[model samples]
Target: MADALLIIDMQTGLYDGPEKPFERERVLATLNLLIQRARHAGAPIFYARHTGPAGSPIEAGSPLWQLWHELEVDESRDHLFNKTRPSCFLGTNLEQQLRAAQVKDLVIAGMKTQFCIDTTCRVAVELGFSVVLPEDGHTCMDTPALKAEAIIEHHNATLAGAFVKRTCAAEVRF
Candidate 1:
């Protein structure tokens, strides 16, 4: 089965804040490498932008809503879609597009590991797509109850065996 890559909510506003995600620089570098590798492997790439309500950081049409300038996005070859909810499939055509391309294995990476990343991984498996979640590719800010490192570690362990295949960005193959 061919594999596809899904980059979720990697917006400029998410990183330009006081509280940044765990290993922000490393994660961005990893994601860019993943993108390059996927392109070389002829894998389809999909970018999902989260649209928050107006006045919010990532409100639609706002500068913050734009994808991070550092990301390796090629509009001519990649697909971009907007979503509001945590799950990328909930209100988007992501599933349909993946199915149309005959893609059954999905490699997901991007921001807010505790929210969009977590939700998308679970839903992708339920949708019959085998998901490869790069353990170090997605990240988030610390929460009141837990540090970002703990959250990322927790989700990696929790989602590893059943929901998705967990691996580091360097170990992930397109």
Candidate 2:
């Protein structure tokens, strides 16, 4: 299966709050490394930015909707798709872009572990694409009741080896 990298919602909005996500620094370091590795290997890289409705923090065309400054974005080299919902495949050109790139295996990593990352991973598998999830690549903020680490672990436990294969950051070859 040909592989592609889908980096979803690593936007300013996700990082601009009082509470930061668990393992955020690690997520950024690992995700950034994966991006570089993917580019070096000539794999198709897709950046999925969330486009919230009007009045939302990440509203379409808003500054918060933009990718963080640290993310390496080259419009001429990578594909960018705006998603209206949590799942990247819903109401976006993601599938078409994947098909055009002849991508059959997806390596996904991004924000809000139980939302976009989870939804997209399951949907991709259901849609017949192989999925690979780097264990340290995604994260979310902690709620008042639950810790971010626990939420991340819970999702990882639920998704890994079932909906997707869990691998480490440096171990991901493509």
Error of 1 at 34 (Å): 0.3
lDDT of candidate 1 over 50-74, digit per residue (tens):
9989888788889989999999999
The CA root-mean-square deviation of candidate 1, after full C-alpha superposition on the true structure, stands at 1.2
The list of candidate 2 runs beyond 4 A from truth reads none
Cα lDDT tens digits, model 2, 1-174, are 338999999998885556787878778889899999999899989999989889998898898898877888778989988988889999887888898888888999989898899999999998888999888999999888789889888988899877998888788876
Model 2: lDDT to the true structure: 0.87
Per-prediction backbone clash count:
0, 0
Query: Which candidate gets the maximum lDDT versus the true structure?
Result: 1
Q: Which pairs of residues collide in model 2?
A: none
